[model samples]
Target chain A: MTWETVIGLETHVELATRTKIFCSCTTEFGSPPNTHCCPVCTGMPGALPVLNRRVLEFAVKAGLALNCSITRHSGFDRKNYFYPDLPKAYQISQLYLPIARNGRVDVRTQAGDKTIRIHELHMEEDAGKLAHDPATGLTRVDCNRCGVPLIEIVTQPDFRTAEEVTAYLEALKETLQYLGVSDCKMQEGSLRCDVNLSVRPAGSGELGTRTEMKNLGSFRAVARAIKYEAARQIQLIEGGGRVVQETRRWDEDRNASLPMRVKENAQDYRYFPEPDIPPIRLSEEYLDALRAAQPELAQAKRARYQREYGLPEYDCRMITSHRALARFFEALVELGVPPKQGANWIMGEVLGALSQRAMEPGDMKLTPPTLARLIALVGEGRLNRNTAVKVFEAVFDRDGDVDAYVRAHGLEQVNDDALVREACAEVLAVNPRSAADYRSGKEKAFGFLVGQVMRELKGRANPQRVNAILKELLMQ
Target chain B: MNITPELVERIADLSRLELGQEEVLETAAQLEQIAACMDILNRLDTRGIQPMSHVFPVENVLREDTVLPSQDRAELLACAPASDGETFLVPRAVE
Candidate 1:
């Protein structure tokens, strides 16, 4: 029997604010252990937490981007749990009134474009880091990451296959990057996700007993774990064994998951309103300013790239996938480069060069005006496509002068029609057999003559002009 | 409301409190009395009243997002029960 998987995600994004959520400690990652903590973040007794203003602003902007309605009045809650990573044995979170709610995002899937509904986005404090030493069997607790500002975005169970789950995540990551709130680097732990998945008969209305998988490090791991868990549940059901609700740890090495905590052992984080932190009330004017400051997101730019520049859907998607690449494309357009030509350069030559060197588009130092001048040179027949490509490689990273390189190398095309015709005549006279072959309907002979003609001109001749001149001489 | 033995046992377990049978009974009586005392406020007719999460009528007392120097690491780690100069050492636990 076919089974369907239902999935939802709770994604925690560490805000890119300068300080911690409740304290003034720097939120920088990779500091020495326990070095960035203060009395408030380390949860010293009687040390009260004062909410950071930037954290609230970042959360509101995130809510606006995701189409979530900002909760004008939201308060904090204490999620009580006793873990060594949590110094105070409680996490400051939100439950009664979250920062935002009822948002939706559109993601592209193999099936089609699907919309994932966001349940709520709430601001919270991150817990400390725990590094287990296998040798000593002791866990090292680092409080440096403690109290970092995070927004936990919870999504409705709108995902089906693992593809949709990852698609939604990619779309979400892109959106967050566009929002400029979080770095959204999964490797750096700036963005973390917990998946809640259940399986059921293909047409069943009731969901099977679900399992929680915490922190499947990468997107690939998330997909693999989802597939593995769904199969495990199906096999259990078919074997007359019931699936138990539990938190499972995904072993990336084993390619399977092992149960970590059963229902009975799971800590019930008894939540209550935090009395120390006052409820936040955002005024309409404050929200309007944030809205005004919001940049044009990747999705909107993708649409605009298609509508305004007449770019294809594929081209628009590729160019606007990253903000920097899209900006480059737009700058080229503003500099009088044809939109289609700019799109071509980005998707073809520009992206190709970066990938060849194992670099990101952001690392590219090639300015748009420089590229525009190079393209204009080709349009004016001063430099052919081959010479232009050679010039591009030399100046890609250093942002060296493209025109100077062409001039120094004498790589400019032979634009003089008289010079091209004389070279064609000389090649035909020297290779009469090939010219005879061309006159007798051998097109290969005509190509050979053109090659000779380009050689006679020291390869500076425009290939198109050479071909046209050689074909005329052969017909004669 | 009657506080059942099972409910008392669960609450004691959550708090990690160990108690004898007589102590459990005593704790249950005290908890019931506490609940009853709060029920006194339930008798008041306060319809359409917004529930207050905090006692004080204050909101949005927020601080700017700037990095203030952290307390000296050695000083902070010295207060912990155990530390290895850099991190607090906990008996190896993963959950």
Candidate 2:
């Protein structure tokens, strides 16, 4: 009996806005306890929330970017709850009419590209943080995060594997970042995911009971949580135990999930339209303008990189994973470096440096002109490949002038054929036994002579020229 | 609407409120009547209409990257019920 895992995600991304969604307080992270709060955000009596105009524009931009249908009329609803993090008791969320719906995002995985259907995206205010004192058993609530703007992007239950889920998340994050809607910083709690997972018998028409995993902060955590939860559910079903629908939290240190609470359905929240704010009506002209503002998304950019730059499928996918890297690649091409060469250096050197530091390519201090110069130098043979690596390392120190650096360090390629020929002849003359071995049909002697010449040239001799001279000397 | 004793107890537990026997019976009847009035929302055909998440059509709210002023620590601490000059003081809370 085969089992299949079904997963959907509700991702919340804190918008990279400056102030709280409804108040004039700063939205900066790590402020003094309750310092960012104001009368409106703190829900003081008689204080009113004025909608931030920038929040709406950002939401519309995100809707257009994700290929969603912007509703001509949408408004806020009150989600009633009694959590201590929300001082207002009832959170102002969109339930009756969301800002956008029916969007689609394409994610590439090992199985191939899959289009994940987006259920909807809505704007809402974030709650505060609860700091629990383990020693004293007291919980303190910090309301600094209250009223911070957030967009909850919900997806349909379309994913089957952990890899596909990660691919979809990566694509979604890249889309949101490229749209300039949110920073999507998983470490800073800017982006978070709640995964709902269930497993059913292969070819079963009915959906199994699913468990929801909350507060998955990292992409890896989300994947691991889904994998563990799916296996747990399948084993329970096989063991003749019922899989209860509940909410679980992923403990990263233990690498396991523990039950948190019973999951609540929509009926539990008792949602009603918010009376504090008015309904939003987006005009057709406004929608058109928003649609026009969206830049080329990941899929379009990846396809264009393949067709326009003649990059391989893998290179195009890697280079276009982040919009910043894609832009850097284009900038290098604009600097007149060949497309293939630009792709190779960025995918190899730039990514190599980033991974070494556990950083993103955009975090690299190396500018486009600096990378372009290094590639051009290697392409033109002014700096040999081995010496170019040294120059690239020097880029971290804010140095430029690849040619000058190589010249000052005497790292120029000894590509002169006569010089290589002389060195190869000297090696053949000294290692007479090897030369004799070559004359007696020992093909290995050819590599011995090539190494000798490269060592004599201090690794600056071109390999192609060394091979040619070694063959020429050995044949003689 | 006839309120069940069992339903009344469940609602009391869920709301995390300790309810007396007489208060529970009255609260259950009131809730059932309210639910009867709210049930009309289930009949509306909402096939194509999107759920509203926010009221105002606002977007792209941003703040400048400049560091701004902050409140004095002593002034902020004045609002706490118990304080030790530098930190908020509370009752012995943990094991």
Candidate 3:
């Protein structure tokens, strides 16, 4: 019997809001433990939580970008659970009425374009971090991340393969990044995903017993977990055993999943509406404002890049993957650089430099104007491509002055006619046989004379000017 | 949604409650009464009534995005059962 895998994702993205969702505490990451906490965020007795306006705006913006219908009436609920990280013992979430629902995102899979439906999106507060000290055998809780705003986007079980899930995730990440809702940094735990997977016969209409895996941190881990879990379930069924519905933890090191809890052991969350905060009722005017505020998403930007800038589809996709890179490209084009040149430089040199230094586009100190200036210098015959590349590296690495570095190193192209003439004269004197051969209609010898002139000028002489000057001197 | 002794025991375990034999019996009886009451409420035929999540008519209750300084570490951690200046210390959690 052929088994087909069915998968859905519940992704939690920490909003980029300046403050916590229900408190005035800063939402900055990597602060000293417990420093960003307040009475409200720490869940102190009698401390009330007031919703942060930015959280709602960001959530609505994300919903709009994802093609979700924003619910006019939504509210928060309390999911009661006992855990060390959750000091309140109840996480404020939305259950009865989520803020948005019925959204769809089109993702490119091996089977071609597939539309994945978003079940709902809700706002929630983040719990604290628990750090276990192996040496001391003690657990410490850091509440600095507590109360950080997050939006949980739940998708329907529309995926059949790992590739589809990954494509959906990538598309979702790009959309959120373009919307500026979240950093979507999986490494930093800014975006977390839990995948629910099951396997059934290929033509089976009903889903098989599903297992939920918590905290598959990276996309690769999600794909691997789905593949491993599906195989395990299929093998079990093939061996005359039934797949148990349970929650499992993906052991990244072991590259397998271990059962955490079964359905019988599942904790009943005992959800109830939170009375501290009122229901959220958004007006049509507010919805319109958010819709207008929505920026060009990655797909729209890709199409625009193709239509307006005449960029290739592949180039458009690569350039628009990161909002920062897309902005950098646009800035360069706006600074009078040709779109294709800007795309080539960014896709080649800029991306190469970032990868070489193990840096993100957001960490790049070289501004777009500075890069545009460098490209302009190269285009105006002031600097050869090689020297311009060196200048770009220096500027990118140290954030140094590009023009100053070029001037200090004398890396400018020697396009001066007199200087080229002098260099050509020296090369001709040194390579008399090559010059004689060039005058005698040996076209290949002309290239040798040009190379000699370039070497005499220490590669500073422009190749085009050198060719022209060498031919003129040889003809004379 | 039948309430059984086993179901009650599971709920107690999840809630981290240790119930004596008599206490479990009494709690089960009381839960049965509550379930009967919920059954009566469920039997009502208010077909068009909208499900309300909150009592108030207000929505979009939000505060401005501003940073307010948190309480001092000493003051806040003082309420904890155990703390070491920087973090709240708890019994070691085993995975």
Top candidate on TM-score is 3
Instruction: Estimate, for each residue in A1-476, the C-alpha lDDT of model 1 and write its tens digit.
Output: 88889999999999999999999999988888998998888889999999999999999999999999999988999987767888898999999999999999998887999899999999999999898877677888999889999999999999999999999889988888878898788988888888998889999988889999985889999999999998999899999999888889899999999988544634677789999998888899999999999999998998888888888999999998777798899899999999998888899899999899987676789999889988889888898887787788888878877778888898889989899999888887888898888888887887788778878887788998888777776666
- Candidate 1: stretches off by over 4 Å: A262-265, A418-439, A445-460, B1-29, B45-47
Q: In model 3, which residue pairs have backbone atoms overlapping below 3 Å?
A: none
lDDT of 1 by residue, B1-95 (tens): 78877788877776668988998899899999988987998899889896688888898999999789999999998888888899888887663
DockQ numbers for every candidate?
A: 0.69, 0.16, 0.69
What local lDDT score does residue A101 receive in model 1, on the 0 to 100 scale? 99
lDDT of 2 by residue, A343-369 (tens): 898888888877887887667677889
Give, for candidate 3 chain A, the lowest lDDT window spanning 10 residues.
A259-268
Interface RMSD, in order shown: 1.5, 6.2, 1.5
Tens digits of lDDT, candidate 3, A172-206: 99999988889999999999999999999999999
What TM-score would chain B of candidate 3 score versus the native chain B? Answer: 0.83
Sort every candidate by lDDT, greatest first. Answer: 3, 1, 2
Error of 3 at B24 (Å): 3.8
What candidate 3 gets wrong by more than 4 Å, as runs, is: A134-136, A261-264, A398-401, A432-449, A471-476, B1-10, B25-43
